[model samples]
Target: MTIAAPTADFLVLPPRPDSTADLLAASARQRGMAVELLSGPVLPDRLRHATGAHLRGGPVFAGAVAEDLDLVLLEPDDDWLTRLPYEYTHRDITLTTLGEARWSRTPMFVKPPRDKSLTACVYADGSRLPGDADHPADTPVLVSEIVTFLVEYRLFVLDGTVHAASRYATHGRLDPAPLDACPHRAAVLDFAAGLLDTCGDSLPSAVVVDVGLASDADRGTEHWAVVEANMAWFSTSYAADPDRVLDVVLRAAGPRDRLAVRDRAFVRPHAAVG
Candidate 1:
């Protein structure tokens, strides 16, 4: 059943909006779209029962709201990163259940593949992993060899192209700058272009792909490698253009029926219903 697009575009925001969401809402309004800043986490009756609603927020709120609404939440597959070429990842990585990760003997960066259910950081050993009582042992997690990134940039991609980019961090610190003004813009965009040309099909039409220059001590050279992919709706705009970021978010979380057939596979599992 295909649902027609509403003549008026509507964007739903959480009650306590963050800087990024506020910027997106402002952009949406500038485009003449309706903005509904919620009174709480709960969606108002008007939107709760309406069709063709678009939203932007954290994963928890999006997940909860998606359960009853026919929303399209785009996200890469849980194992999408592990499946990428070694050239792009530049680190040994594996996708396994938490129970399996509990047996790790060496330090590794571990995190839930698509959610913040687990803290994402390097752990000394498997003993540090939460017990079965906390989260299910079967929960999927990504374990990777630790690598240091000198500088990190986030690319807002749409239709296999880098729509906008910004330097969000440097040496593990928050140091943001618009890509256009950054010295590394050309290299960052070029590296990202190569990556997308090879593996763009693995992601949704709209997404956030982080990349960084990693120190390879053994090779005595620094090179770029992918950091991770995130749902556009839940990602920060940083110094990227708000209008461009809003364009991606709107499509990333718009009505399910409007989703292109090619992107059907990239829809978040929780949003599979609609």
Candidate 2:
């Protein structure tokens, strides 16, 4: 049922090759909902024909992707996203400014909220950040309070609904176990629902959220907390229901009218601000 290129909606993708990207594109074509693939993160031809896209990792693709869908990408410092879990979940999660933490002498899990260019890792201290890990000191990074969990799952959220989920890690290790037998499935879904309901207007039309369960806690009273939120365009689908995830990816990466507000907020180019 794939639509002919002339009449199909366009999905802008990066110039890179990835199986996940291919699968998503194939899924859309099969459904008669999409057509020719456009490579972007840049302005594309026939912008009006674009239905969705998985743009490159650099520029925030608001206008570059399309000019109709009001898609806004989230980063680490997003107040709307920060407030969702802070106010709703019992999980001990909080967001902190990277600049304020620069002088500190404690190791913290530092990551750029949405951009992978900045690199996310445990820094022994702001002063100890590697030379190659170049980003402005004022960058608002998510310095999470380290909490160990037994398992972690990523969910595709659209308009405050959990559409698909997959298990990606366990016990501080990358575990690709299937979610079909995950005992925490019910709890994770329930936790996502609770947080989504409290989203108000902050939740994007599409997004991804990671949830973790602390098995180190007391018996029968384990806890569920949000690991973080990611832009769906670049997020790994892992093992969630692909069809369901496809629904979210289309909207999450689709063209939007919002004036693209982007920055080299992290390890900027060695030439410009190096």
Where does model 1 exceed 4 Å of error? Answer: 1-7, 271-274
TM-score winner? 1
Question: What's the count of clashing pairs in each model shown?
Answer: 0, 4
Q: Compute each candidate's TM-score over C-alphas.
A: 0.93, 0.75
User: Which ten-residue region of model 1 has the weakest summed lDDT?
Assistant: 1-10
Tens digits of per-residue lDDT for model 2, 110-138: 77666664667778887865443456556
Model 2 clashing residue pairs (backbone): 69-256, 76-113, 134-267, 135-267
lDDT of 1 by residue, 61-172 (tens): 7776775567879988889889999999999899999999999899999988777789999999999999857678998899999999999999999999999889999999
